[model samples]
Target: MHDHRRLGRELHLFDTDPLMGAGLPYWLPDGAVVRHVLEEYVREVERAAGYRHVYSPVLGKRELYEISGHWDHYSDDMFPPMRLGGGEGEEVVLRPSLCPHHALIYRSRSHSYRELPFRIAELGGMYRSELSGVLGGLTRVRSIQLNDAHIFCTPEQAVAEARAALGLIRRAYDDLGIRAARYRLSLPGGGSEKYVPDPELWRRATALLEEVLDGIAYESVEGEAAFYGPKIDIQITDPAGRESTLSTVQIDFHQPERFDLHYIGPDGGKHRPVMVHRSIIGSVERAVAHLIEAHGGAFPVWLAPVQLVVLPVGDAQEERAHDLVRRAEARGIRAELSGPGHGTLGARVRAARLVPYQAVIGEREADAGCAAVRLRDGRRPGAVPVGELLERVGARAGDRGAELWAAA
Candidate 1:
């Protein structure tokens, strides 16, 4: 098994400093690029699924969580509330999840039944107070930026909304070539005061989630549900065969009631809207960490931080290499040139393994307007035309292709 923490340091992906507090990681430039690309891809997917994006404050008034029932159940996991001014000032806690803020947004304006299944999404930062013993690397951190969304629909529309969410999950996994080992249907256990007091509501939520899960193959696990409701969790097997949750689609019955959220029906009657909570990519940092380990730091071509690096053979070809870098960038390939002085071909190629493709431009190849293409896989496609190389790489990235190279 590849140690992601070691890879993280060696690859300059991220680092944590004691001065900055624990469980907080500062992303290096290379790692930041990967995160940016991943966030963009996720945005496109969410946009296509009819999710309207929004940005909400990272900290909400303590009363907000109180109304959402998070204060009672999840407050221990949240950061201590920040008290401003004197005793008169209200306390604000860093949001542990986006569900309540989104509920408030849904309640901000009146919605008719026609607007049912309203979806609001955000790539929002959250804070939690993880125990020091469990805090290790990017996988378990106090600071998390999550791909979170909440769907507010009529109770009658719950099944269709869940089905739509499952479809979105499947499409995203297919795009990234991620196959979950299995699905886990997590339901609330009885007699847990942490769960909401409404037994019938729990039954309804559990039934709805089970109906959704029954349509797909899944295992049932009691006592794993969130305080609010039941959920479907995707369990991904890492390269080491350890299963971890990567995403979830949950049915929340408690939050709507806690917040007294409602929408108007066709007959002009007020009815509570069901809340469906989902995290497509879950914590972005954890997802990236998983990808780093799964691919052994050799991300798929489209997702690699730096897709191509130009290695000039000698001083004579340095300018040519820089020009090619610009040309590659113009074609939408993430390209960079080696530092001023060139390194040995083998050393440069080895360093370029951190990237997906490397082009060693020497006097001969520069003069021929081509590059000796070296893929991450140990294959050298000798003297390919620079234009053709750019076109092919760009196409792969545009299509989100997984392979770096294939036999032709």
Candidate 2:
């Protein structure tokens, strides 16, 4: 088993407690840094794709689900409603998905075919009434922050839009050095209560997915689709020979009709629009957990919670260490200073706790105006210069952990 508790505490990442209940994770300073960096990268990428970011309230009115079919289909995964104050019975519910909210946005506005594909994205929190027994670490939690996006598109734009979603997933994975990710078309279950009653829509949507998956490296997985629609689920394998679903791009054929949503067409007549649902990077918690394990806590410099840890060789050189920290911080590097312990050995030991980058600040280097950087990146190391260390750090940061410095 992975020593998540030890690593989380020692690295100052995150933790869980019996008192707080299970299925929930509490992120400490280090873990939250990972979240912030990951969110920055995700938003940057999504924005480049012309996706408009938006937010919806975490708690929605109980009746909101009745309009979205979530009450009938997804009630099993939802938290029970809360009766607020007095006179209110089952009045509030934690939203299980953003589709309902996005649908409302679509209904709130009038649009023409010219503005065909309206991509709305959010890095929002979703809650599930999961069994406390099943909760582990970040991988399985009651609360999840996901990269969710809903696209309002015409039938003709469906194919290109699907490709765009695929590109986003691929690019994100590639940036993270997840070279083995593959897509699976999650299809409707045959004769199952999980499926919506419309067989014709399922057929059309599945066909469109197959066409979209054409020439793309993907496989078809049966009975894996969400009840509402078929989806292309992205998969990634860990070092332990276990695989899990990471991201998804789903197609909805019936939600538009259910929500009574439509757009003006080239013929100037009302026509139904299709919904393209997508989540790249899946849940922020799960993704961070996998990264920690995959890289064994020795994160790439770009993703490192502490990109550079400067050690003051002695009390006399403490001022220089502080200056170094400021320089790194100014350059957007997550630099930290250490004067609590003396000597390079203490610094090395303390830096070892984080699994990367150490610098020694002694009188020799302080006089030389350059700190000796020890390249202890989970492997053999000795010393380099401060400026040289920053160059390597900057390069790794640019890579976004795509080609991280792994021990050969």
Write down the worst ten-residue block by lDDT for model 1.
339-348
Which digits, one per residue and each the tens of the lDDT, describe model 2 over residues 48-85? Answer: 99999998888888788877788888899999888888
lDDT of 2 at 387: 69
Clashing pairs in 1: none
Candidate 2 least-lDDT 10 residues:
375-384
Point out where model 2 deviates above 4 Å.
Answer: 1-6, 340-347, 353-355, 378-392, 399-408
- lDDT of every model, 2 decimals: 0.86, 0.80
Tell how far residue 233 is off in model 2, in angstroms.
0.8
- Tens-digit lDDT string for candidate 1 (188-278): 7866887877789878988998888765889998888888888899998777787888999888888888888998998889999999998
Instruction: Specify the highest-TM-score model's number.
Output: 1
RMSD score of candidate 2 (Å): 2.8
